[model samples]
Target chain A: MHVTSSVRPPLITGGKTYADVTEDICRQVEGKPTKEWKIAFTISVIVLAYGTACLFWTWWEGLGVWGLNKTVGWAWDITNFVWWVGIGHAGTLISAILLLFRQKWRTSINRAAEAMTIFAVLCAASFILMHMGRPWLAYWALPLPNAFGSLWVNFNSPLVWDVFAISTYFSVSLVFWYIGLIPDLATIRDRAQNKVSRYIYGTLAMGWNGSAKTWARYEYISLILAGLSTPLVLSVHTIVSMDFATSVIPGWHTTIFPPYFVAGAIFSGFAMVQNLMLITRVVYRLEDYITLEHIESMNKVITLTGSIVGVAYLTEFFIAWYSGVEYESYAFINRATGPYWWAYWTMMTCNVISPQLFWSRSIRRSVTWTFFISVIVNIGMWFERFVIIVTSLHRDYLPSSWAMFSPTMYDIGDYIFSFGFFFTLFLLFSKYLPVINMAEVKSVIRSSSEKLPAKVAGVAKGERVANPTFNKDAE
Target chain B: MADLHGKYLVGVYDDDEVILHAISKIRKAGVKISEVYSPFAIHGMDEALGHSRTRIGIAAFMFGVTGCICALCLTIWTMGIDWPMIVGGKDPISIPNYIPVTFELTVLFTAFGMVGTFLVTNNLGPGVNPNMFDPRSTDNKFVMAIELGKNKLTEEQISQVLKDSGAEEVNIKQF
Candidate 1:
């Protein structure tokens, strides 16, 4: 039986029945796109068009259009890559980790979050391709055998590990998200009035009849996927961090990179989720499904992960001095007081100091504050990666070779391209798909809904047996 | 496409808990249930229908094992046995360095394998028309279908049993 604590606020308000859940979630998919959606879509497409042109010219001109010097080979490309990849982590965390934890609130937001993961990874992968001077030779990164050579991709290289990690993560996340969508798609299919809509949704639904045996197997497979994904998500960022950590650079070669990067990933990821979801909740009028409780719960996660990232930053600094290596110590000192100190301090203020505001219950629950800070956290996270990659390389060993890096229009445009691509995909998904997991939410209605009478609510306080069939009128 | 051909008695209920209780009652009355469909998965309905636990987890484990083995073989065969080359000043057969790729491939194989097995076993795939008892079953209704050929009870008797066991509506469905 479904059981939830009485002290906790109702996960679903408005006393939604199974039919209401279906109606509320499916309305967006079945109905016409709103004016706001049209406007947003137009803007995103325009940005995507301009950015694509810049990206095409960058590739056509052979990476010379961007500001990459001999001293600093990596710049906004790798930074944006890590930043977008980190943003993708929140989706898996909400879907897989929260599923394992049995968080019922995740039912409302997990679909959109997981979609975000897929699109964010696509944006991140775009950066990888853009960074590769010859995008056609990108397959060389894979471990495919060549007809002319005995050299396989180096298994010892973290870059090779990244190829495997990212591809696996993308495919697995896509499968998991699609599997979860089948039942909901069937719901929409069954309700569709138009023949074409019915046929399209019917195909996507895959003939899901909701048989008891199939449901049993479906639940089991979902659990197994979640189990596999937890470690997979952690491993992805760990491997990504190892790309730098395994290097011999004084600031990059640190033992703490794995945990540090993972925490930072979840931190930035939650902030991105907050930003997208807050807008989605308002634009779609999904305040009932994505309630204030969900917002507060996600804010708490942002706080916890943000704190871990803060500690990691300080720990890196202390260790730099504690290691007594002059190069390592100088790297940390230069990061705080170097020419790129604005970026470093911006990272500190946005990521470390900003999320601390969530400690106040009001601020955590306030939509305005949450949205504002989420934007700040995203900016800070981008700078965090920029600081690590650029500062470490900009002033490496020899003074004669040291140089400051600046981004040309191409670098800025490529970064904007990701934003354009991500928003374009997300807007389409929200417009055409059920943003909430209807079946999962319906299952919890008996236990977590606010339709219980006063007496039943009192009885259910601090105890089980909340009476599953309490609200006959609700059905 | 004509996987199901049957004349059946369909019982519709609104609440999951009520249908769950009705399943045991109807079965106790000696009527065999062909299937029960609902918008959401009803807990304990499988046990109430006397279905044993599914073995998809076992398949998942086996797939995971296969993935692990394949990853290990790929790394070892390519890095060590095929062409031994020293990269990053490490051994060609370094297992520690192989851990990340090995772990990733294991998860990838397990996820794809398990989902493939699940879809295949459920007879679910794109463009497959579902054998539906009631359209509302996907909306708000819990539909219990009893194949007339499998059940020993008369249609009238089965309808009465369904009505008495809390089915809001009972009807005959032919496919």
Candidate 2:
């Protein structure tokens, strides 16, 4: 397997030193914000301000502020919640799944993706609180004893399960992200020139000395954490899918929902990662680190998972017809030909058909094409959630009780508010932390142009120079 | 730097392979190495230094078991005993339904417990002053430090051993 070729593609394209890696990442934090960063940060802050205003209005005014009726109790709120939760999945999949599979390319992008997971989950949890109407009583979802005669949470309910799953997922992701940052934080700490910066980076670094003993344990802990996170990522999405599956709603009650949702979660998750990565690569001027090869590899994943999600769409219909359940059959038919047919076709075209273009190597390799398709795919996934929710709830078993669901100004505002929250946190994260993992990326640098270790001048003069070929093999 | 203790001899190298080679050579010569630091982890360096494997996985597994049992007991006590009100015409104590929460908590406890164990074992956390041998160790250099007071050999002998092991630069450090 040691095929030393002149054409071997380096993950880090530019010949870079460990010092360059540190400067590339730490300068973004230490230096003043660039003009592009200033513009993006301002937009995010404005969006957040407006969104917070809408949420305050919802709080002061009540549930009537939104366009929820008796028939469609969960129109946009739950849809946005599930969408944000789904977006969070790609981050963990990139970090934990790729690490487990020994995909070394993830070293360049995993830090940013994990940050995305944390922010996306935060946006998702906000919807749950807002949907509660009385947000102050949000803790009731927890399995806690109450003052009124020991009324505990209902264990059989999926909503209660959601509280545990989401809280656990959020906390675990936070710890995992923080632990991975320690070594890099130490790099920043060592490079700090000012007193305040030294104190901040030093505290975050947690006194890492980078000893051989410490490095060994750090690696062991990382592996165990990766193993732990694999199942947790799958479980988080599975439990979220259960929220719909356990219900009696015709479109919602399928055994296929778990796998189907997981696939779609990954599909959309990669799209968002691509979306953010494209902007980051350009804004941070990091084309050498996040090469077009990286983008193409991610597009390959988006295409693969996107196709799986498409197959899931068809499988749901086939099962609906094969089961001979009239309600299920009607639900499928209505989704295609009902008043919301536009949304249905949009989802199919974007998620099912559009990503098929990636099968072409030229399109997959093109940054512009990949970026355009990623955005379209994200739009399609959002519509998929909307169609599932609105199409199912809008129609009733009795025609007399049937009603159409439409979003009010408040609904639109709340959805926009989530974007504001997600972007705001993401922008801050990019500016404050190393956008790429410095320590992990340093381990992957194998450029032949790197300076070789020289032999000691006296007794070791004739000894063979150690070039790290075996080090590369062990890694 | 006021509380500086014993003098430390610091050896610097540019590559991990040289450090690994030097570690084995120096250890073979019977010089005690206090620690080796690098910008990135050099695989198998611990084994070269004869350090044993870490056991943090055991702590993780035990923490997971505790989470699973605690989750099950809570589900049973609340759904089957404390307030067993039937909803959706299902059984009060539903084992399958409780699986999600159980799994979630198990993962949660495992992750947090392992991280805490790592911090305590490594003596790492905010406000803990780090023992920095050289600032460039976090840059493009690898550093191996040997304490003069810890080893039976004199400082000059250890410095000679480091030079023979292919260290590019050897200097005396105080911290």
Candidate 3:
């Protein structure tokens, strides 16, 4: 709202104008590396190396290198897979889904979240690719002619749909991410001082000269793509849910999986965004552009989606008891009071119970509290998948096959390697990509010009907005 | 210059009220109009200029239909026609199975169709860039116009009409 030209606030106050925003965003390349970057780079590389080492050993050793008994076949690997994939949901959800809704707040965070989606999916895929004992023959999943059993892949199977879903999801998100990056890359190309930086950034700029026709069509195509991607994002997680729901694995079987899974994905993804943004906002000296208001807005989404996940949790317990089948009943009871009750309650406390604190304004507005909750929520979600995968399998139909699963050093290494995989991609993104959509963020700086002040005043009180929050209620 | 026969008196403005006032004034004065343009499109500007709702959306739908047919034909040619097999408990022509490819083709066709139609209708394509008025028109200004000869309006009358309607500046150009 502040429109002054030359009265720039310190980076900490974050009261930057358009030109200031441009300069601040470009600061990473314009300025040489500081001590802080060195520290961050050092830590990321160390952890990343550990992660890679863990991955190499697992690939060399085999599937049994980690831990997956017949009972708990999914265990930590699938849990990590689902969790990483879930973490990916928030990015596209924020970018595509929110764009369709025209949520202006998304502009500040979408590029980073989209990057997160790409990286997190890469991490999740690494786990999937590695988990394949015969990594070379993973093509058995594809619908190639003359493959095994003279057959096309079963469309009925969620796993088959997932191959399509994940691949489509990856390409769609990648294209969307790349297209969005074009203008920002041009901005960087124009701003770069060094010859090497200019050449690399200039090529990636794709010859964009901010042509009016291109911008108009760019806006149009972005809208259409967002519309297309919105359903794709939902379908992806829904199909992912079908992976579990299609089976009769007690806690995994439920109609609630799609929405619940989508919500949890957003919740964890927002947390990861919070984690990354908090660090970036601090380190990059971009407090004004990535303001507390932006963080608060994201925190609001986290709170709301987290509670949505909370309700899904309660509904699962309610439905399990209501079904009146002993296996289902015991499944619910087993998750709570079984041998892995600690894991179950940990999931509950982290995912369901902790997010409720957001109902209070004090906590949601506090960066320190939000960052802590974001981490806890992510942990809870990972454990949530773990609890679902393990508890159900540990006591499926007979006690004879029941076994407690533990991650060997191999399991730990693969997990670490996935982390390495995630951070390595993330570090590259942070260095190279726009990191935030400068054009979109610039458009957002002026706020919605058409909004009647009376309508916007209502937002201060924190009134709950309906899904697809637009003129439906306001008008 | 052969394409310049349909000369347009495109009036550009900033305020919505001025554009509305100008359009009404021109219509009352018995002047036929062409089109209104803006940086970010303004709602109700079409109605002011008496433009029809575009068939671009309809064209998109038709393109989508074409895409579905193409998808079906291709699937049939591949799965049913060329290399038919009966591995699962399903027919090759099942629409449920065709959805993924169908949806993609539909989008691809519709998008390409819209772009093609937009370019053709607007008289633009490869190696053709139209003359621009104010540089800022595409940034935050609004534009309105009529095909000059169709309305039988003189340049002076148009200028007066534009000034009365709150146009900051007015000009005539051939592309």
> Which candidate achieves the best lDDT against the true structure?
1
Using TM-score, rank the candidates from best to worst: 1, 2, 3
Q: Using DockQ, rank the candidates from best to worst.
A: 2, 1, 3
Ranking by lDDT: 1, 2, 3
Scored on chain A only, each candidate's TM-score is: 0.96, 0.93, 0.90
Estimate how well candidate 3 is docked, as a DockQ score.
Answer: 0.10
**What TM-score does each of the candidates earn?**
0.96, 0.94, 0.75
Over the full model, what C-alpha lDDT does candidate 2 score relative to the true structure? 0.85
Better of 1 and 2 by TM-score: 1
For residue A76, model 1's alpha carbon misses the true position, in angstroms, by 0.4
lDDT tens per residue, model 3, A1-475? 1122223211123333344556667777556767876676777788878877777777777787777877777777888889899999888888988888866667778888999998888888777787777678788777666646365555445776677677667767787787788667766766777898877776776554443344555566667667767877787788778889978878888999999999988899999999999887787766666666677778888888888998998999999999887788898898899889999899989988888887777887788998899899999999988888888888868878888999998778778777867776777677667677777765544332222133442221112221222223223
Q: Write the per-residue lDDT of candidate 2 for residues A1-475, one digit (tens) a residue.
A: 1122334465776667667778887889888889999999999999989998998899999989999988889989998998889899988888888998977789889999999999999999999999999998877777677783257888888888889988998998899899889998888889888999899999999999888888888888888888988888888878888899999999999999888888888899899999999999888888878887789889999989899999999999999899999999999999999899999999999999989999899999898999899999999999999988989988988888799988888898988899999999999999988999988887776432122222221112122345434445334
DockQ of each: 0.62, 0.62, 0.10
Model 1 chain B TM at: 0.95
Which model, 2 or 3, shows the larger DockQ?
2
State each candidate's clash count. 0, 0, 7
Error of 1 at B136 (Å): 1.0
In candidate 3, how many Å is residue A203 off?
A: 1.1
